[model samples]
Target: MNETHSPAFQREQLLAQDAATSNFNYEEFRMQLQNRISHLEKRARQLQKAMWISAGVLILCFPAVLVIEGFRLTEIPWVLPLWSGIGMLSLFLAAVFSGIYSSRYRPLLKRAQYDLQLSMITELQAQVAEINRKLAER
Candidate 1:
């Protein structure tokens, strides 16, 4: 059975492959690095938006429940009140979950950014080394 690689593992492998190249393909490496950086930036923005949305909804929960309870819509059955409470609870939980997920996404983005920086620095060093070699040959 073939072992399945996780996405993170796969990304690391790709970066390693690029970093390990003895002959640098400047265009391809730059494009790949730029693409990865842009992708991570876009993802981070989207997740940040989601986090803010979730936070807004979460913050509104108390007031929403208060407003609903204050309405005095029904008297005897109490079903609406019960359902409203449950609904609020569910919404709150969902918001919390979204926020938590967004938080996780942030670290992933940060790590990707760090990797991008490292790759850039490595490429720069490689270029410098190549230049030094040529200078020595002259």
Candidate 2:
């Protein structure tokens, strides 16, 4: 008997086709989720590093300003470099205090690294669980 004439042949053919497509779709979706998770994690790390650098600079600004003022560099009249240094000091102080109500460095930075990273990681792990669930059901 020809294969097309057999009921088993048709059923097996359909099942094989479906399985192939489903596996492909699952792999593609999983890869997309993993890529997204990696991108988010990388961004979070970069942001954390940047935040730490900013915090360090802000923290150092206090003593740095005092040192500059104490050196009487501000008294140098018509010197562009001295004026620019004073201007930068003023700008740094302005940024440090620009935060609402508290006017602090840490709060303004918000320390958002951990929470954001956790959320994305949780999402990625949840997708993994979903994949496992589907595979188990199959």
Candidate 3:
């Protein structure tokens, strides 16, 4: 006479519990993946912007150097070296940022957005097929 003692009732209870847990886990996992992808995208963008800014600095350096030399501003001992140092530093920063963005963050962001999602979907499909098979067996 007890519903709790019935197989149907027990199966329903287990299924309800599983659905609740799976839904929660899926949402949390999806949010985490989205956050990670967002962070990667932000970093990639920042690196790209920085590389462009450095390029701008390097570009402007030439004219500034020319102006300094034209105006005979290099008469001071430190003036030329200062501009040279700035130019060199900007060039180095641009190269480094470009390399990091192209080689590291950009590739990683692409993988995370596309390849990783595809792999996860494949895995989830396999898990679903297994679950269906088990249910059929039951």
TM-score of each: 0.44, 0.41, 0.59
lDDT of each: 0.70, 0.66, 0.88
The digit string of per-residue lDDT tens for model 2 on 6-59 reads: 999998788788865656777779999999878866655555555556556656
TM-score sort, best first: 3, 1, 2
The 10-residue segment of model 2 with minimum total lDDT is: 99-108
- Any runs in candidate 2 off by more than 4 Å, and if so which? 1-24, 76-138
Error of 3 at 116 (Å): 23
Q: Each model's number of backbone clashes?
A: 0, 0, 0
Ordering by lDDT: 3, 1, 2
Best by lDDT: 3
By TM-score, the better pick of 1 and 3 is 3
TM-score, predicted candidate 2 vs. hidden true structure: 0.41
Predicted structure with the largest TM-score when compared to the true one:
3
Q: How close is candidate 3 to the true structure, as a TM-score?
A: 0.59
